[model samples]
Target: MSAPVRADALATLTAWRPADPGQRALREAFLGFLAARPDSCARSCEPGHLTASALVLDATGDQVLLTLHPRVGAWLQLGGHCESTDATLAGAALREATEESGIEGLTIDPVPLHVDVHPITCSLGVPTRHFDVRFLVRAPAGARETRSEESLDLRWWPLDAPPDHELDDLLAAAQIAR
Candidate 1:
């Protein structure tokens, strides 16, 4: 709802460089969306909105913290809509990871690991595309987590094996980033 987050989202997308042509294309589209819509980061924005999320890894980087998102009915990483208090897209990613994981001492790579666009029904009660910027977060060694209401269940899985097959490429990118 504030200008800072929207500004940050614009700058973040502008400055990002990805090796993949596909990601590059998405990044360009996201930049265009941000430039045209002042409310790009807000839930009120129609058709599409920017969401930040993180692929959480343990200190050893061998395990990943995943949540059973009730709305999506799938095991996914921690992250959500950018809040009014967020000053940057990276901070919003960190906030979502911490809130959904209930774990402290989590460190994040400020640069995005990946960006995705997926159609879903969100709080707006209509179909929209989530322009998700994904980052990598590392939890403290053997860090304990408390389940937040946002998840149907939260747990850590071996990095090599996740409940979602779609995460394979994203997780690989995260591993390289970390």
Candidate 2:
């Protein structure tokens, strides 16, 4: 419900095109939360806790590697929390991709592609918020991958026909902008 989060959620929801009933509901709920809680802050079940994540593009710049998130069952970029050990947000993103995708020789652009703020409804029905700072990264030339346990599946996807998911539009936009 912070101003930044509210703005991000608003933009995301407006640009979103949900492909399934469940995703539509989820998207609506997220949009509604932002509309209702313009100033709710982190404590109000609003998106908070900044996390650094990445959309890893391959060396040729035609494909992006994505992971199938365990909980969400959706294809997404590799990223995680910026723990105390991380020197900067970009470092956190690098560590996460290295750990999650097992792809070596990567370089991340310091600038974030987008700031995604979303509320993750946990199994216990407790919602955790994430203000995800998403960066654009590139794998070394001809670098191969070994998907880690963190992802159900990891593979390179074309920028135009990324695997079906709710964030497809956002991902496409990010790729084009990059």
C-alpha lDDT (0 to 100) for residue 104 of candidate 1: 91
lDDT of all predictions: 0.91, 0.70
Q: Write the per-residue lDDT of candidate 1 for residues 1-178, one digit (tens) a residue.
A: 9799888888888889999999999999999988888888998898799999999999999899999989999988899998999999999999999998889999998888999999999899899999999999999987998899999999999888898797887888877776
Q: In model 1, how large is the Cα lDDT of residue 42?
A: 93
Alpha-carbon runs more than 4 Å astray in model 2: 1-47, 121-125
Error of 1 at 9 (Å): 1.1
Please provide, for model 2 over 68-100, each residue's C-alpha lDDT reduced to its tens digit, 9 standing for 90 to 100.
999888888888765555656667788998888
For model 1, the local distance difference test gives 0.91
> What TM-score does prediction 1 earn?
0.97
Give TM-scores for every candidate, taking all chains together and pairing residue i with residue i.
0.97, 0.70
Best by lDDT: 1
Q: What does the lDDT read for residue 121 in candidate 1?
A: 95
Off by over 4 Å in 1: none
